[model samples]
Target: MAKYGIIRMQKFHKDAITGIQKHNQREGENSKNKDIDSTRTMFNYDFVNEDKIKYHEEIKKMTATRVKRKIRNDAVLVAEFFVSASPEYMHAMSPDEQRKYFEAALDHISGKYGQQNILYATVHNDESTPHMHVGFVPITEDRRLAAKDYFHGKTKIRRIQDDFHNYMNKRGYDIERGEPSELQHKSVHEFKKQEREKELKQLEQQVAHKEKEIQRMDSFVELKKAPPVEIRSEKRIEELCIQPIEIEAAKTVRGSKVKVEETDFHELLSFSKELQQTLAAEHERTNALSREIDRYQKENKALKHDLKETKQELQVYVAHQDGEVEKAKKRMREKLVHDFSAEQKENVKDEVKRELDKQYEAHISSLSDDLTIEKQKHEKTKKELVQANKMNDSLTKMNIDYIENYVPKEELDKANKEVDELRKENKTLKAWKEKALNWIDKHVEKIKQVSFFQHVGGIQKRNKRQDQEIER
Candidate 1:
């Protein structure tokens, strides 16, 4: 079988980030895809980042500084690149080789859209196919968040596949490129429907064939119900025997013996004997036919029971599959609705924030203009006041006596009392100063007397030392 390297890209808006994280990271329950084998889930690994990457946070971090403007709610926050090869190709490779294959694919994506843009490169081994789920922030080289810039048109999409295939081939993978997605790709629902239809058709054919066989057997039994050839021959002989006797009776007188030829009598005797043998053979054949019919009927009944059970089993299986499909659809529908609702809310919030920012900026600008005007007016008033002061100064520095002549007597008395209190404080400070000086003088006299005594004692000790030296 020809093996192909497969690469598919799916865009996820900001609102869908959480769901993508849940699916790619295998968070929560495995309700999304039944193919997930939890036993093999431990083998799942990230080829890019070893650490568990929170997709929402990673996208936010990528766009926080780069994307200056408020992000649109419908904007593609992340693009997951599904990288895998055909089952034959993947199964043929060793585990280490598979990891290298994924790593090479990651390098291709990272090279195209900087390694920093990769949020996560998780390879899931639990699913039916071993594929890498790469989360990428679609940030352009100019530091702008735009998924369309990289993956927008059909031409670009095709080029993406071409490049990936070429890149893988060059790296020695030797895998064929997959068919055009538009031509060969089928939705999960359509694929399942086709498979189900095929199974049901085969079952129908089986049942129809069995029914035809039963019908044919029933026809054979009905045909067998007629008497055998031997029995038929016996009936013909009896008719012949009666017809000859009737002809002879017409010729003979009443109550007279119908005299027949000896040959005819012998012939009649043989016919009677043959008739007895035919009847006995027919009786045996009839019994055998009845037994065969009974066996066929039993077999036919069994076949019909089997067909009915098969149909019932098929019905139950179909019901279960349908229920699972409906549940998946319901979950998908609810998730879509939630994502849409969240996107709409985020869009509304962003729009409101933008409007508010504009209004605030305008308000601040207006206030700044008004403040500037007020500052200018104040400056002018200040200049005028400076000139008035200059003129007043030139007119006369207000004579101190003239200004004092208007003083209230009560205020003057208050000022006089403050001066009197200050004088009392000054007198008290003088007394404390005199006491401090007298204490300093007494301590200085005591210090001088002790120094003089020490000097006398030193002279006496020197004289004693000189006397002792003279004695020695």
Candidate 2:
């Protein structure tokens, strides 16, 4: 089979596009080393100007500053459509067929991305394969210069290839569009590797926190009682300062003593309440963290299971790819052999045709010679035929005269009637003979059972052979 066609598009500025146009048109290439056939241009056209000379003037008209929302830099696209010569797709073509193929492909390119966008197209057949290099400005349907809008991603590239492939296939070209690269989806190993790394890091962090929390819980369990909260006795506090001051102020002033005592007790009570609330809040936070950690652990296990499944799928895909590769290789080898044989057969056919043409010329010349001789013989034969016809006419006249004078119609008719009566009598006798034969046939079996049939048919004594021969 012919290999797939390749079309490569490159963005270029006006100057570069011009350079390409010149090179492709055989103006830029060094004339000294170039062959007339090699690097030869089949036809070049400046679609913008509808001229053959220069596309610079044309490019300017197609894209200018006046065009709205235009990209100033990537104004032109130069693309090469490489046709395959292998397996004789290009090699097998007549010059006209090759031209048509390239032209049709160029038309396909233009049709794909609007004909207005194409500035220049030239078919080159002097190369190994018939191909075309076309330069087009990436203009949208609404006529805006937008290269980024079209081929910025692989989606357009794949789609263009698919469309081109279908077109070529319909035109009876033996080629396939390449399978799109699966780079978007990471390989199983790569994905698993990255995922495992992240999972491992998360697992390590969770395990560390879990270990610390377990230790804390263990420590809490080991502790039979809560930490002792220190409290100051009201009497001790009074002895330290208030008692001496109170006594010095008034020895029997009980109301002042009660007021000082009440202030110290209230402060101690508030401190104890705040401490209890802090302990309760910390306990709830720890419980919540533990639950969160357990959930993460379950998630980690599920991820591991998913990773296993992905690996299995990857293995299956790889195996399938391997089988397909082997089959493709086998097909390629077979195709190569077939092509070689077909080419050899074609060469043989050409030689045979050449020989046949020579023979046919000789045969025609001989036939012409024979025809002249035959024509001479035909004239002589015609004379003989005329003489024979005269004799036949004379004989026919004599026969007619004899019939009119000697043989009368009445005598012929009477004889015909008598013959007809004899034929009827013969038919009646045949019918009677058939009935007699049928009667004899019916009685013959019964006659065989009698002594007379035994003597006539040479019947022997009944035995195994006799029973086997006669089914009844």
Candidate 3:
């Protein structure tokens, strides 16, 4: 029973002002501008209410404190309203009647929103539908925006829309409650449009690429034909010289006593020899050129094959891109049609978070276990090293004790015999003792020079320091 209409408004000043002015000028000069008189129309109307200005100023002041300066100045206030009018009411109205209705609606909304200084409100009836594009400056008397304070809560926008609808209904404009289905439909429409544009762009690019490839192939074919012209020219020159020789022969007297001039004979013979040489050289050149041409043709054929293969690959790539585009469109359409409620979305988010947390915990637990195992292995290896050092120290101490205090009977007997031999050969215990002490001192010094002290008891710490000092 009602005719539906959508309304939208935004704050646009500097650049928007320039664009709007230009557009309005163009529209005013157009012949079709008169057609709009048959439909409802509304234009800029001055709002001089002081109370409205004060209300806007208050909101602006609040916004200035919380909103960034750059964004605040550049920000646009967008408002959309959906209204429905009875068919009878719409059909009964004249163009002027419809225009007045829109003007009244605009005035009512401006007053309700307390937007006294706003400008540039326009109604459009370009489609089977009607809508409005309203523009206004965001600045207030205090030269600040109050967006943050005025629309702080999520419900504020809804409240504004409701209030505007109520105001419009009160002012005799038919208004309708919005349906969720319409919003969904609108979203789907916009999504489809975007998908179509994307697909079009991909197709255009593929066409352009194919066109370039064709151009390149044409150029290659042209290059291949270029050398045949020179060969044709050489053949033409030989034919021209043969034609002159035939004419001269026809003019000569028949065989009985044809006395040829010596100079003429020499010239003819010379011409024959030169012709033979020229033909021989030309034959050789033609053979060489033929070989070269054959080689080039073979290369060209291979290149053409490669180009064909490349073109095939390009075709496949284009097909793949097209498939991807189709797949993306299908996915987009599915997403658009599949409606998920807020609760369902929230549940999905929670489930994903829980799964991620569980996986993260499992991974961290595994890492900690690995770290624990490595730590235990490190401690065991350290303990084993300490125990091995203790065993080595015990063995070294035993060796030292044996060397310092005990001697085997066989070794002692051998040593005594060697001493007696030495005495018989030289004759003095003092000399033998001196030699033995010297050998003992040398052996001790050598043992000390070696790293054996590092494994011996009581000398381990000093040996470790000496080793460390040497390393340094």
Candidate 4:
């Protein structure tokens, strides 16, 4: 019976796809753990995006419905479908039939699931038995994502098995379920495993039986040699023989028959010697066979252990690789978002720059107009100060003429005091007008600098500085 074990691939493993690709494409030809000629690509997927980063992008794109902008990082990367049986099951069919069996099996799986879910389907012929390794993403037909869903309950797995078998059988492959004993209930996989174990146990029993037979033969050999040890003395043996010891049909060590009165005694001695020699050879052969079986069993166990360890390491390595790929992808995405933000900021900055420039130009123009008004006001004030000074000078002249000409002393003093007061007030007005003119010149220079910067790249430079700050 053919069996298929559906296994979930660990999330984010680099080896998940890399190793399969190597096996499927025969890339590890010279490596010690090469999968050379072990796999033939029954199907290929162009979706993996030879480029690792791009592959992830493709997955995200294809699964966009299930995987939104924010998807789980620990989503399953792959699932393995191991389909196999003993070599006899596969070799029973012709090459064309074998092809059909695998093709149909995969077709059913793909059809049952979604075709987009399957990544690769490879037929492996390099091991003890012909089998296939299929990799797929755990995506459901309705575009839902969940790796742990399909193999959750017995019903689903059974349906999968039945459907697979149904597909294969319908396509002319004589695949069927194995029979279980009346008192026993077990899965096909378990049954196959127990059957193999039973075969091994039987071989072990055979080895033990051979060892027991060897022991029995050894005991017989020892019994044949017991007569030599039982012979108490040579004198007694001669007396018992009643005459000279004669050997007949008794081969000596030199393969020559000897004549003697005690022919039976010679024969017993010769037989004991031959049996001892035979026993030595038989014991060595039996030990050798036992050692061979032991060694075979030990090597088989070691191979199994090594294979398990290698698989574990492969998974670990792939996981590490996946981390790296994810990290790389993360870097790219961050850079992309960063670049987008920067472009947006640049656009905003441009808009702000235009607005700032417009406001600056309007402000400078307003400042210029105010400066012009202030300058005109200062000129008018200066002219008024000059007129006041001139008027004060004429009053002083007129006061002097009055004081020196024909006025009373008291009246003259009063006029002089009034004229002095008018002169002081005019001087204060001149100082205040000069201060106002200096303030207006200072403000005008500031407005001109503002206008200059507005026309130059000062606004842009300031914006760039702010942008740099924002980036930091």
Candidate 5:
């Protein structure tokens, strides 16, 4: 596989600082991301900032020392950088090489955006991919906090990309730079969707393979466990019985003429040996079937686990896609506002404010009702899960040869159909929940921004009036 160096930047305002810290530092008790393997979290370490410190404190200190002017409430507080390469490439490297790769990237960023402005530079190993998170205060050379000064337009962004690629290449790493196209700038949602689709396809193939094996086993068991055949002839081995035959009194010179029964000693011994061999063969066949059943059960369990993981991944993707959609909508609204005249802008803002307030109330009420319904459904699902567990336990206690007798082929098919339906329903519910939550978050942030700007606008007007009076 081709290994490419990847770097992306995200801007965060003061309001998002706490969230950023919590995620980057892994401070939360419960991690929402199931992809993170917490056991490997110990390997995670920082480069620029050796100690784990609060981002808020670092931002505060940087602003106080490096920045002289006041930053706007909506100003980008931190320019968060996600730096990494293709997982395959990272995995192929030695421990020292991986550290060097991240360190070089960090050095390049610090060089471009001032080393003193760095808030934190952490390398996370717990997630699906090993990546580094670097936070810069965006303090300009003139000692002003302005993210736009560094990442204002496409030209600047393109140049930064080029520099990182060239710098890494010069550092003796054969990593390719991002392609200069829309394809190179894939959103998180698109990346996750592609990954999930590929994983789901693999899981589906595994499930199909298991089903085929189970069917083949079913046929094998039927043939192997059939009753053993009986032998019959004129001089028959009647169920392998050795009956005594009466050969009464008389005929031998040395006989005392006593009544007695005669038996064929050699014949009986030969028949007994043949019967033992047949029984041994049957026993071996039973043991073989048992082993096959055990193997099939293990594979079936693994398939179920894969399906469950796929479901969770799908839920994550749904949440991400909803968030992306909400962001796009917010961007569109901002663009519209930007294109408006000053007078028109005021009218549009007021109209939008009123509409948003009304919609917000309606959405909250709808969300409350939906949540209640979902809670009930959640309870029902829980009960179903408990019952299913009981059924599974019962199945575990069943004889392997008789599993098909208890769970017929038709019932198995029906159960699988039901599971598929439930999965689809769960996906739909998750998407709806994500949409509602993202909408709430977007509107809440917008309301805060509007209020802050309004206050700032008032201050500017008063200052203008004061200047006019002084001139008069």
Candidate 6:
């Protein structure tokens, strides 16, 4: 038989355990160190009973300190029930099944109240009745208890009992009560079992109804007195039942219905044959469509790959073009420098030539002045020569007369020496004039072959090109 109970535990300290032990000692119970099973303890405290102490220790280990203390308080208020079996009721379950049932019950409660509200739960066979002691915290983290708000002065406990009964009934258990109408007396397991049986019966009836309909249709098809038409009229009923009802619902729906004349049976037969042929043709067409879709998908994938490759190739081409552009720019820069240097050289040569021309012109002017002075000196020398010649003639005449009469030898010798020295001076002047004319000839040749003029044409061409470029 299934038993029911609620166990409430409360937090206690070391002092409380000590006090309890002292009270038990006074009552003549030897609460000394003993080898008891540690699993029996509800709270882990240093006590004489090792079993009880270890049991609490395990629970404490599984829970956080705050939650453990809360559940400890809840465990203290639990009440166990020893339900009996009779002809008016039945055993809800055996001891083992009761354990499972209570475990499920506890899980359901935990789900409702939250796991933090429950500390621990255990089945105690040592007790008179095989019952479970469920330990829970009365106060939630938000400081509320289960069913307190809804139940407040109402039959909230009854509601919990009903829900629990329904749960057990669904799991295939028995119900026990004085009368079938006394739902209050029925266990949580019994109520759940009855509800589940009703649901199962309803599901079975639905399945049976569907099966009968299918059988009726199959019978009608078998009894048909006409030849198999190529154009079948099953378009109206194709979706009725190919697979199970659930699978049928998931498939796509085809077209809607249309009215056909029944009086023209021959035409109807002919149309049916045509329809069957059309359906066969459509089946082939659908298969072909599916193949086409697959082919298109493959082509799409290939196109995507080709597009990626083309993009990569384009990128490479762009990079190569960029490189070529850079090279062209570099060449252009170098060429600009070379052309500028050539132009500068030509400009320097022109300036040098101009300066040389100025120097040459000044030299020519000085030469002209020297020539004028030389001509004046030549004229003066010519006049002096003529006067000398006249003087010489006159002197000769005088000398002859003097010689005939009686002249001095010393004076004649001195006159001959002075004449020879005058001749030598005249020859030196003629040589100086020839040297000056030769110097003027060399200067004229140097001016004619000026280096600046040699490159002037080329420099002008380059400058024009540069100006054109700037304008552009």
Better of 4 and 6 by lDDT: 4
TM-score for each of the candidates:
0.45, 0.34, 0.34, 0.35, 0.51, 0.23
Tell me the whole-model lDDT of each prediction, alpha carbons only.
0.71, 0.54, 0.49, 0.56, 0.68, 0.45
Q: Per-residue lDDT tens digits of candidate 4, residues 56-84?
A: 44455567766443445444556656565
Question: What digit string (tens of lDDT, one per residue) describes model 5 on residues 143-224?
Answer: 8998989988777777766899999999998889855633344433344345455655765676577567656655655664
lDDT of 1 by residue, 1-472 (tens): 6588887787776666887778777897575455578888899888667767777776777789888778876677888887887767888889999999998999999999888888889998886568888888888878778888998777778877789999999998888876674654433344444545666677778878888877977786677776755355556656665654522354444644576787887787787777768776887787787788888878888888888888886786677668777876886787577556565788899999998788766655644554454456445645654565465444333333434677677876665665566556555555544554464355334433433224434544644653453233
Ranking under TM-score, best-scoring first? 5, 1, 4, 2, 3, 6
Worst lDDT run of 10 residues, candidate 3, spans 44-53
The model with the greater TM-score, 3 or 4, is: 4
Q: List, residue by residue over 378-416, the lDDT tens digit for candidate 6.
A: 466556656765765676666556657644677655644
- Can you list the residue pairs that collide in candidate 3? 63-146
- Winning candidate number (TM-score): 5
Candidate 6 Cα outliers beyond 4 Å, as residue runs: 1-95, 141-151, 176-472
Residue pairs of candidate 4 with colliding backbone atoms? 14-318, 15-318, 245-260, 245-261, 245-262, 246-260, 246-261, 246-262, 247-259, 247-260
Better of 2 and 6 by lDDT: 2
Error of 1 at 216 (Å): 21
* Model 4 whole-model lDDT (C-alpha atoms): 0.56
Score candidate 2 by lDDT: 0.54
Per-residue alpha-carbon lDDT of candidate 3 for residues 273-325, written as tens digits (9 for 90 to 100): 67766766776776776676666666656656666666675566556556656
Residue pairs with backbone overlap in model 1:
none
Candidate 5 deviation (Cα RMSD): 38.7
Best by lDDT, which number?
1
Candidate RMSDs in order:
26.6, 27.0, 27.0, 17.3, 38.7, 41.1
lDDT of 2 by residue, 229-273 (tens): 444444444344433223224435554343346666566556655
